[model samples]
Target: MDAVERLRRLCIDDPVDDAADDPGWSDALDAHTVSLVRIGALIATDAPAASMRSVIDEAVTAGASLQEIVAVLEGLIGDVGLPRTVAAAPRIAAALGHGDDLVTDAEI
Candidate 1:
């Protein structure tokens, strides 16, 4: 499963301009934006929560801001609903280093 994900990232998250030969396709969206939407779709489609952390990490490196990532999740609300959004929030937060299960929780 991890290997599948690694391959997916290699293919889907490649920052190279595969659009080099096609003008119309290349004109549509930037590579960073495309990577972000792919991550959003993975989230919306209910991919494993743990798997998303790495995807999110790659998206961040490719210039997708936290706000943009949240927007992608928000866009799914109409189709997937509030419950999914609620569930995904914590996962995303965890990836972003704000999960509730911090060392502070253990200290208390």
Candidate 2:
């Protein structure tokens, strides 16, 4: 299955732990899926100023709505915790806007 589909399945069908324990889970949860989740978590946690701005920019690029981004972050935080969620946020944001300027003068 495609990455998006696999992620959807992972989110809907099985508990995160069940999928995490599966050998193929990592393969299914591709970079994009992970990024989406991370971006979502960052937004939900009221991340650092730089981090929140970065995630918002990335989510906009990734075609993810603010609400969608928030949902993903909430899910990640609910499953994991603040630290991991925070760590993952920037990466996910970066993934969405790989070379783009996620930060702006106004944001800084």
Candidate 3:
């Protein structure tokens, strides 16, 4: 299967039989850009801390500096609006290892 098809299956918890053979997401975009874009999507969706964690790790592994990641969040504010950005901030921060305290406080 193509890489995008494999990724679609993985997203829904389906197993890709030949996932090991897939070239992965870096075929088009570089790993670093893809990782940062994933982070932005997570932020835009107000995704949970657990979901953000892995993507953030991937971003870091792909050589995304903390500043660039933070810039992704900041840059989306105008597009996504303050409320969504605010709601997502703590989860993203927690995923980045800022502390669960931020998440807890955000919940309150």
The predicted structure with the larger lDDT, 1 or 3, is 3
lDDT by candidate, in order shown: 0.70, 0.57, 0.81
Q: How does candidate 3 score on lDDT?
A: 0.81
Q: Please report the candidate that would top lDDT against the real structure.
A: 3
TM-score of 1: 0.62
lDDT of 2 at 75: 77
Tens-place lDDT digits, model 1, residues 3-56? 454456568875334335543334567878777877777767777767778888
Estimate, for each residue in 52-76, the C-alpha lDDT of model 2 and write its tens digit: 5665565566576646665675577
Q: Tell me model 1's lDDT, rounded to 2 decimals.
A: 0.70
What's the C-alpha lDDT at position 7 in model 3?
72
TM-score between model 2 and native = 0.35
- Full ranking by TM-score: 3, 1, 2
Q: What's the true lDDT of residue 39 in model 3? A: 92
Q: What TM-score against the true fold does each predicted structure earn?
A: 0.62, 0.35, 0.69
- Candidate 3, superposed: residue stretches over 4 Å from native: 1-25, 100-108
Clashing pairs in 1: none
RMSDs, each prediction? 9.7, 10.0, 5.0
Give Cα distance to truth, residue 47, candidate 2, Å: 4.3
